[model samples]
Target: MITLSLIGIGSGNPDHVTRQAEAAMNTAEVILIPRKGAAKDDLAELRRAICARVLRAPGPVVREFDLPVRDASGGYRAGVEAWHDAIAEVWAAELADALPEGGHAAFLVWGDPALYDSTLRIAERLRGRMPIEVRVIPGITAIAALTAGHAIPLNAVGGPVAITTGRRLREDGWPAGHDSVVVMLDAGQAFEAVDPEGVFIWWSAYAGMDDEIRIAGPLAEVAGQIAAARAEARARHGWIMDIYLLRRAC
Candidate 1:
């Protein structure tokens, strides 16, 4: 049987790693890290740094694998499904090679697995192929970092908030019945699609990291600045991970 631990390491900050996650890393027989590409090498490096900090000498065996790139050519949903299947296959092969006898293996997840991350779904695909037991250790989410970074409350007292993706905001407009919206996975800066008249935006890139950047103001006054800033940051870093909160006038 394979004991699979999906440990959340938080948003690129080594200090964000919890004691539980640290203990799990030290106890696991193998830890698998995924290298997305040169552009996102810093992400993989963060995982490695976590291991270096927590794992003792002569500790668990460390393994690295290349992650499958998602195909965005077809419909978004269809492409994502295909990409997940590809990732599951890669994961199975790597795990099997690392533990031919079936042992404890861990994957350090970015942020919490229960959130927008797909590591949980990919792990589910391995159940039929092997006798596996899965465990999750939650970590601080990007939303939390964004809010904390800006020193703002997540919701107005007794008001509702919707957490969604950039694609949804652009394609569907703002969701109904929520005073505030927290947008994630917005590669295209979907905030530009909304009417900026009464909305306030608090945006952050690489939240909680050393090079973290933040911007907040009325949407109309600063939407262009946010866009320009995002462009510049992505150009400088080669990749960017960002999230934002939009609150409509009460």
Candidate 2:
């Protein structure tokens, strides 16, 4: 059986790696790192760096694979499904080649696999077909990192917080009942979808990384600055991963 460990490294910061994740990394027979192409090469590099730091004893082997690009011709959901299928195929091929003996392999995920990530779904697809055993090591999520960076609580006392994506906010507007929302996977400038009145926003880019940037205030007052900063950061880094928290005054 192939033991696959989905370890969360936490927002691309070496220090954010938990001791459990470190132990898993050290114990794996092979570790697969996905390359998101040149634009996001730094992501793969960060994974490598984490391995370098945590795998000091180095019993595990590290390998990198080119990630399949999503087909945008179809609608978003369909495209994503196709992309996940392709990723699964790549994982199967790579695992077969690397671990002929059916040993343990690990993949370093950016955040907790249970949070807005498809690693678990893809791992399910690999089960039964490959005789695989899946394990997860949860780490800090982008929302937690963003909130910590801004030194702000995620919600008001006795209040609810809705975690959502940029597409959802753009298509559905503010979710009912919850005044506070944490948005992730936003390309940039998703705040425009909201009414902006009485809305407060705390935004962070590269939350746990050294080059972190943060902006928080009334949405109307600092939306422009957040947009400009996000644009500049993306231009400089070729890609950016960010999360923002919005609270509408009840």
Candidate 3:
């Protein structure tokens, strides 16, 4: 039986890693890291750094693999399914080669796995093929990092908050019954799709990292600045991970 630990490493900051996550990494017999191409080399590097920092002098064997690229030619849903299938196959091959005999292995995930991440879903594919026992060590999420960076509460007193993705915010518009919305994976500035008036936005890029950038104000006043800043930051760093909170005024 292969015990796979899906450990969340939190945002880019090394210190953001929890003690439990560190312990998991140190105890693993093999650690699998994914290299997501050149533009996101820093992401892969961060995982490696975490391993280097936490593992003992004679640490677990670290294996790096090329991440499969998602195909965008077909319909969005179909393309995602195909891409996930390919990723599962790659993971299976890696696991087989690394641990021909079932043992403990770990994969360092960015942010919390339960939030907008597909690692768990992909791991489900590995079941039935082999005896796989999965463990998830929760790490800080980007939403928590975003709120912490700004030193603000996630929700107003006695009110509810909606957490969603940029794609949904763009496609479905603002969800009902929640005045505050937290948006993640918004590479396209989806806030423009909603009515900017009477709304406030607190945006952060590379949240919890050394080169973090933050912008906040009324949506009408700062949307353009946030968009421009996001573009500049992405150009400068070759990649960006951002999240924001929006609240509609009464």
Which candidate gets the maximum lDDT versus the true structure?
Answer: 1
Candidate 1 per-residue C-alpha lDDT over 45-160 given as tens digits, one digit per residue, 9 for 90 to 100: 88888899889988999999998899888898999999999999999999889999989999999889999999999999989888889999998999988999999999988999
lDDT of 3 at 240: 92
Estimate, for each residue in 1-250, the C-alpha lDDT of model 3 and write its tens digit.
8999999989888998899999999889999999989999999888888877888968789999998899888898999888988998999999999999989999998899999999999999999677899999998999999999999988877889999989999999998999999999987899999899899999999998889999999999999999999999999889999999999885
Instruction: At residue 53, give the lDDT of candidate 2.
Output: 85
lDDT of 2 at 241: 89
Q: What is the C-alpha local distance difference test score of each model?
A: 0.94, 0.92, 0.92
Off by over 4 Å in 1: none
TM-score of each: 0.98, 0.98, 0.98
Candidate 3 accuracy as TM-score: 0.98
Instruction: Name the weakest run of 10 consecutive residues (lDDT summed) in model 3.
Output: 48-57
